[model samples]
Target: MKIDSLTSVQGQQKLFDNGNARVTKVDGQGEQPQPQQIASTIYHKDDPVLPANYGTYDIKAVINENVEDPETMNARYNRVQELFGFGIAERSVDLELGYLSGVESLSQGLRDKDWGFSIQDGELQVIEGSDSLSDEERSQITDALKGAGVEYAAQSVANAVIEMIETERSPNGLSRSIGRFDVNQSNFADVVDLRSFMEDYQVGGKYGKGIVNPNDIQARYFGAGTGIMDQVAAKADETFLYKGR
Candidate 1:
């Protein structure tokens, strides 16, 4: 849904008061209409349909008054990093799927099912059954990836095939990958490179790696690091997370 559809109090109220009425007899008949009973009955007349409420509400002015200007805060850096974390998580997933499955439209696949990118309760979750790849059985994933092209795609598929071949692989592989990358400086640098590549090549920015066609890389990795930060902010009950001193 369009963000603009969110509720504002700009429109007229849906409820109405039917004017308190005194009964008037039609031709002085029908038992004087019984004083039209003042029992507060509600009725609808022919009026246009009211717009549905979109659940938007104004922030309290008093709260806004006490907050610092976001533009002026050095702490914004920390907040940015936090957001980057979620983005990284999603990116990792996208990269794994793309490099492994040779599917360039993975993000669109998620979006089509309304499972679009989201940070919920300190985690990045793309609901299962929301994407085309996700709808397939394990055997199908193996077959598709094995036939995919690109060196990275081949390697990724090999890894997946191996994992599926194993009996007791870790169930939290994705989560653990995100957590591990967050604490690993080397991984972070790789992410920076990936992000830069995305910006320069994929997104048509000046600083991209330019080694490969930017469009060949999936869009999911471009801003996934930001997704992590969104989860942090949402979970911390803050709009922005300042690097804690």
Candidate 2:
């Protein structure tokens, strides 16, 4: 962690002739260190959406869909793929991206600005692209950060942004990936449509349970008709493929 002050020793120096190696304070005798509470929210796709439109929630935008900018879309695609399961698929996608403009660094990858580090949150954080920033460059950034209503650069805002990003990763929700403003849960869920082989095979959902709502696609193989299950699946595949097509 970067700090304002730091000191390191090159060699050992002793001020006292003797030292004591004993426990001075018992556990909980002095002020206790409290765990930092993450003041952010999380939810599942199927869970209730409370605090609806409450505060300035993050709106996730999928590349090619919402984030249509060529450079930015391509630049931020790595985050989408790393956080979300798939990258930009031909299939439709609408997601609420966390940290679209917060907690930025000199990304070795794509940058939002032409040159230098840029964070497009409430305040524009611009770090000049130079090995050693000049006095003018430093003043420019400091003044920019001190602008009115520049809440995005604040630590609280940055924390909230991280919370939302973590939500969309593996432990993400269907609604979260589709929300205008939402967060992902701490788990993962995937699906597959059956127009190919093994149509009758079951795919379990979270916690190894059958999908809460089954028979949702193709009417469970176009109505599992009265016949051997395997035969029904085979016929359904053929029907959906040759007949429907």
Candidate 3:
């Protein structure tokens, strides 16, 4: 939150005395007061895709596989997952995997003019990369984003590139650790999959009223029979080995 302007201490004091709306107030007799950053009121009603309180949605209904039309049922289920759950898995992985390194690479690319991107007045712009982009490459990027229904695809590309670059320059402490753990120590996909399954279990227990079992949903989704279930149970048991110890 950066303040855009400054005010006099006397003016701030007078404002306080008059009970006027307060911004940042400087101390001392002659000091100038810098205005505090105000929170932005602007928000996009449609951009987030899911509701803020998405947890309240009827999970069982959303994941229904028992509908008469298999194609319709699959489509409906897929749509729900895309809108609310697993569809973002790959993107989430991309955003997490080698995050720091990818960012560094992107920054280096930008600096070397190998990738085309720029920031001016806090806004990202996609310019020509160092080696000029082929028309085919440019068209491919634009077309793919357009196909995905992204508005302002060029700007989004620029922003994403900039974010990746900036992220490499200064990634969060926890993210750096997590990225390392995922890359060097553990199977990231297994972790994400297991977490998703466990989350479904909790969601079912909370709202299914004995009707929805997360394992049942997993079985259906993965075409897993009893043998697979047994193996899954074993995996789960192994994962929770220290739970009751």
Best by lDDT: 1
Q: Tens-digit lDDT track for model 3 on 56-121?
A: 222111112232233443333233223223322222222212221223322233334343322233
Model 1 global lDDT (CA atoms, 0 to 1): 0.26
Supply candidate 3's per-residue lDDT for 42: 12
Q: Which candidate leads the pack in TM-score?
A: 1
Can you write out model 2's per-residue Cα lDDT over 1-245, one digit (the tens) per residue? 11101122122221111111111222333344323211122323333222352111233323232313334333332343222211111100110011222213223232222223222333334344335565765454445334422333232322333343433332222332222222212111001111111122123312112433332222121111111112222222221121110
Q: What is the lDDT of every predicted structure here?
A: 0.26, 0.25, 0.25
The candidate with the higher TM-score, 2 or 3, is 3
Ranking by TM-score: 1, 3, 2
Q: How many backbone clashes can be found in candidate 3?
A: 1
Please list all clashing residue pairs in model 3, or write none if there are none.
113-130
lDDT score at residue 242, model 1, on the 0-100 scale:
24
RMSD of each: 23.8, 28.2, 25.5
Alpha-carbon TM-score of each model against the true structure: 0.22, 0.20, 0.20
What tens-digit string does per-residue lDDT give for candidate 1 at 1-245?
21111122122211222223222223322332222222111111121111121111111111121232322222322232222322232334344433334323234433234222212222222223334445453233333333443223323322322222121111222221122223222122212222222222223333223323322333323333333222222332221212221
